[model samples]
Target: MEIPRRLPSQLPLILYLFFIILHTNVATTDTIKVGDWKEILNDTLVQDLGMYAVLRYNNSTGSNLSFYAVFEAQAQTVAGLNFRLALQALDADFPRLYKAYVWEKPWENFKNLTSFEPVLG
Candidate 1:
C-alpha cells in the first residue's frame, strides 16, 4: 500500500476546524444565564405548575385567590426546573396579574414555591 504524503498538510487544518466547532457547540449548551428565562411555548405541564404555585400560595397565606388563567410562562433549567409564570387570578372578583416562581425536581417528586407576588403593573 502506498501512503500519500499530501494528506498530513490538510489533516491539521481539518482537525483544528473540527475542534473549534465542537467547543462552540458545547459552550452554547451551557449559555443559560441568570434570569435568562425562555418562554414556554406550549407545555401544559408548565401551565399546571403555574396553577400549583397559586394554590400553594393561597394555602400558605390564607388568601382566597382563584386561578383564572396562565398568561405567560417561562422556564429556566438549573439543578432542577425553575418555572416563572405570569398568571391571571381573581381576588374578590377582581382580576389581577401575578408572578409565580416554582422550582421543581420532578424525578425526586419535589416542588417548591420560591416566589409568588402580585404584578403591580
Candidate 2:
C-alpha cells in the first residue's frame, strides 16, 4: 500500500495546534492565598538561599486600620521564576483589600508608591 504525505502548508498549522494543546495542558493554574504567605516566609531554605524576603506593616492606631505585607522574591534564576510564580498566584488568590505592589529588582528598584497613595476627591 502507498502512503500519502502531508502538504507543506498544513505542517505549520498542525505544529501550532499541537503546541497550543500541549501548552494548555501543562500550564499551571494554581494561585497563592493569604495563608500561603506564612508558608513561604517560614521556608528556611528560601530564606537561607536569599531567594525571598517579606516586609510587614501593622497599624495599631488609625481611622483606616490595616495590616500590609509585601512579599519580595529574588529572581536570579529558574528557582526565582518559581518564586515569582508563587507570588503571582498569591496575588490572584488573595485579592488585596488595601493597595499591594509586587516588584522585581534591581529592575524595579522603587515600590509602586502610587497604589499606596490615597486618591484625592
Q: Highest TM-score: give the candidate number.
A: 1
lDDT per residue (tens digit) for residues 18-96 in model 2: 9999898778654553224322452554442222222221222223322223334323222112332122112335424
What TM-score, to 2 decimals, does candidate 2 have?
Answer: 0.21
TM-scores, all models, native as reference: 0.77, 0.21
Q: What would the per-residue lDDT of candidate 1 be over residues 1-121, giving only the tens digit for each residue?
A: 9877987899999999999999999988945666578877646786788789889999999999998888788889888889888899999999999989999899999999999999896
Best-performing candidate as measured by lDDT: 1
Backbone clashes in candidate 2 total 2
> Against the unseen true structure, what C-alpha lDDT does each candidate score?
0.87, 0.35
RMSD after CA superposition, every candidate: 3.2, 12.0
- Model 2 residue runs over 4 Å out of place are 1-3, 7-13, 29-41, 45-121
In terms of lDDT, model 2 sits at 0.35
Q: Which stretches of candidate 1 lie over 4 Å from their true place?
A: 1-4, 19-36
